[model samples]
Every structure is written in structure tokens, then in C-alpha cells.
Target: MLFELIKLGVDAFSSWNSNRSEIKKIKLENKKELVQLDHELKVAKAQSQIRMAEQDQAQTYNLDMQTTIDMAKTYKDEFILIIFYIPMIMAFIGYQDEVLKAFKSLDLMPDWYILIIVLLAVSISGMRGLFKQALELIGSKFNLKGK
Candidate 1:
């Protein structure tokens, strides 16, 4: 579009100044009309640029808002999973003695070794989420909200 406008200017200048006697220079009234049209074109171009900027700003803001919403939803899901994992880990700890005895009665290995294996299983299953929740909680307290 800008190219077309530049071409129009070039064509107007060349047509009026070409070495053709039949084509005369613009009269005073025609010159005034031409100047008014040029002013109107400039105003129109500025208005177009302003509208484009407004649209681009709105698009960027909308995308930022959407990304925020998606992140919030993901955090909420993680929070719910944390809620579930904490109690399960606590229950395993609370029954540790009884669980060890049961393992002792059934095992072909030492009871302490069986206890270590069970603890490892329980910790592996849920400790990752415990650490994640702890870090997030600390981050929230410190005002380290991520973008």
C-alpha cells in the first residue's frame, strides 16, 4: 500500500513535468485542491498507524492474560495433587513400626533392610511432590511469582 502511494506521487510528478506541450502546469485553484488532498492523505495515514498500534497492543495484552490463566490452572492442579500426597506419606510414617514387623515376619532378608526398601518406595512415590510444594510455598512467601 505504501509502495502504491509512492508510485502515485512519482506518476503525478512525472506526468505534470514531462516534455509534452499539451500538458500544462497546474493552475492556482488546482494547486490548492492538490495540497488539501495531500494533507488529507497524511492525516489518513497517521490514523491508520494509530489504529494498527492499538490493535497490536490489545493482541499482546490478550495473549499475556491467556498465558497467566493457563499457569494458574496448572498451579491449582499441582496444589490438589500435593493435598493428596501429604496425607498418604503421613499415613505411611504413622504405621512405620507395624509395617516393619509385618515385613520382618514375611521377609527372607533382615528387617532393617526391608524397612529401608519400604521407606525408599514411599519417599520416591511422594517426596518429590513434597519438595515441590515446599519450594512453591517458600517462593509464594518471598513474592517470587513467576511470569
Candidate 2:
């Protein structure tokens, strides 16, 4: 009877040991899966943050571009008024004749003076057009808000 009891005890202990080992293996697998899940979550969170930052940067850049476009348009309008309207007003008021006569009395050659005037007018007009084109190019490149 004593021998039988000893054998039963040994068998029970072996079975318990086997169950404990299986439990340990299951727990290890769960821990590994949990770690993997945690890592994936961290990566997802980081990607989201990066996307948010990029979006914010894009918004800031767009705002800056819009502001630049607005400023350029304002400057263009003001310059146009100064360059064309002011001259028109002076001519309408009959000040152009006096001004031309005063400049003519300076003993300058008529041909050279005319050439100089033509050149200056052409240059000013060309520069104004070029500035407008440059502003348009910049607006297009930067996605600026403008008409």
C-alpha cells in the first residue's frame, strides 16, 4: 500500500508540472503578442503626429503665400495708380506743357531728348509689366490666394 501511494503521488506531481509548463508557454505567448501590439500602437501614434505636423506646416505656408500675394497686389495697384493716373492727372491739368517746355529750355538737343523720353517711357512700361508677370508667377508657384 505504501508503494502504491508513493507511485500515485509521483504521477500527480508529474501531471501538475506538465500543466504548469503549458500555462507558462501560453502566458509567454500572450506577453509577446501584447508587446507587439504596444509597439504597433506607438508607431501609429507617431505617424499620426507626423501627419498633423505636415498639415499644420502646409496651412502656415498657404497663409504666408496668401499674405504675400495680397501685399503684391496692393503694391501693384498703388504703383499703377502712381505711374499712370498721376501722369494723366498732370497732363489733364495742363501742367505737362509747362513741364516739357521747362525741360526743353535746358538747351538739350531735341532728337536726343525725344529719344531719352521714349526710352524712359518704354523702360517704365516694360518694368511695370515685368513686375506684374513676376507677381503672377510667384502666386502660381506658391498657391497664393489672389484674383
Candidate 3:
């Protein structure tokens, strides 16, 4: 009976030690993840600052960017540009799943409704300046107006 009890105790001790070792491994993995997350957060902050500086530089040089800049500085332009560029980027990057996930999370109004409201507030006639600028850009690109 004593020998059986000693064997059982040994088995329990071995199991407990294995569990402790596993816990230690998991804790080390969690600590590593925390360090990686801290580095990622720092990188994200640096990227945000760089993006803001780029927006400031663009505003200084680009007159067409003035409207979006004046309205909400970097944020408005960034939101619009994100909507425009992210899908384009994702298509090239092969991240269609992320785009679909974004689409699924949107609980907003339909596009046609937003279109009608925008047209009323910002008419096509109001875009003449933009149209002129685009024409000038194309003309300059083709050297249509004798440089």
C-alpha cells in the first residue's frame, strides 16, 4: 500500500512539473507578444506623424488640396483618400478578405442617397475649377500649349 501511494505521488509530481513548465512557456510567449505590440504601436505613431507632415507639405504646394485642408486639415482628405486608395492597394496586395470585412461592418446609408445629398450641396457647376485644373494638367502633360 505504501509503495502504491509513493508511485501515485511521483506521477502527480511529474504531471504538476510538466504543467508548470507549460505555463512558463506560455508566459514567455505572452511577454514576447507584448514587446512586439509595443514596437508596432511605436511604428504606427511614427507613420501617423509622417503622414501628417506629408499632408502639410502637400497643402503648402497644392492649391487643389486647399478645400479639403481648410475643412478639416488632414483628416477629411485622409478619409477620402483612404477610401479611394485602400481598395486599390488591397487589390494589388491580394487582401480581398479585408475589403469584404470592411464592407460588411458598414451600417450606413446607401450610396445613391449620399450621391443625391452631395449633388444638392455640391453641384456639378461648383466643380468647374477642378475641371479646368484637370484640363490644364492634361494639356501640360501632352505639351498641348507650346512650352
Candidate 4:
């Protein structure tokens, strides 16, 4: 009976050791998983911060552009209008011959030079889409062989 009790005690100790080892291994696996999750969370946070910074930069750029446009709005159009009217005033003031000569001289310039002037005028006038339409019209007219 004593031998049987000794054998039972030994079996119990063996079972306990095995269970303890299994628990330790499970705890190690859990620790590794937690470390991986921590790394992923840090990476996600960094990416989010980067995106927020980019958005802030974009907003600042847009605000600056809006402010500049607003400031220019006060005098840009008026100045352009007055400059354009100067030619008309000169024509009315008995300088029609000079104005005609100036325009005729411009006709002698290169097509590219004329295109540049037109583009500059269109941009200053804030005439969006007109440049493209003008190009298309000019292209179509030039392409016509007879009609």
C-alpha cells in the first residue's frame, strides 16, 4: 500500500509539472502577440499624424491663396479696365491714326507673340475656359481647307 501511494504521488507531481510548463508556454505566446499589437498601434498612430500634418499644410496653402486673391480683387480689375479704355480715349481724342498704326504693327508680329499676349490678357481678366475655347476655334478655322 505504501508503494502504491508513492507511485500515485509521483504521477501527481509529473502531471503538475506538465501543466505548469504548458501555462508558461501559453503566457509567452500571449506576450509576443501583445508586443506585435503594440508595434502595429504605434505605426498606425504615426501614419495618422502624418496625414493630419499634410491636411494642415494644404489648408494653410489654400488660406494664403484666398487672401492674396481677395487683396488683389480691390484694384486689379479696375486697373485693367482703365488700361483697356486708354486706347478708346486716344481714338476719340483725334489719335485714331496712331492707334491704327500701332494695331497694324502688332499684326506684323509672330503668331506665337500674339498668342502670348492673348493668354496674358485672358489670365489677368480671370476668363477661365476661354483660352481653351479660343484655341479650339482657331484650330478649327485653320483646319478648314476651303470653307
TM-score against native, each model: 0.34, 0.47, 0.42, 0.49
Q: Show the colliding residue pairs in model 3.
A: none
Candidate 2 yields a Cα-based lDDT of 0.71
RMSD of each: 18.9, 15.7, 22.8, 13.3
Superposed Cα deviation of residue 76, candidate 2 (Å) = 12
Backbone clashes in each candidate structure, one number apiece?
0, 0, 0, 0
- What does candidate 3 score on TM? 0.42
Candidate 4 lDDT, 42-98, residue by residue in tens = 999999999998896676566555645864757766776887788789999999999
Give the TM-score (vs. native) of candidate 4.
Answer: 0.49
Candidate 4 segments whose C-alpha is farther than 4 A from its true place? 75-147
Q: How do the candidates rank by lDDT, highest first?
A: 4, 2, 3, 1
Predicted model with the maximum TM-score: 4
lDDT of the structure predicted as candidate 4? 0.80
- Cα error, candidate 3, residue 61 (Å): 2.9
Cα deviation of 45, candidate 4, in Å = 0.9
Per-residue lDDT tens digits of candidate 1, residues 34-139?
A: 9999999999999999999889667656655565566564564466467557655765779766656754676778788877765454343334344445767999
Residues forming the 10-long window of minimal summed lDDT in candidate 4: 124-133
lDDT of each: 0.67, 0.71, 0.71, 0.80
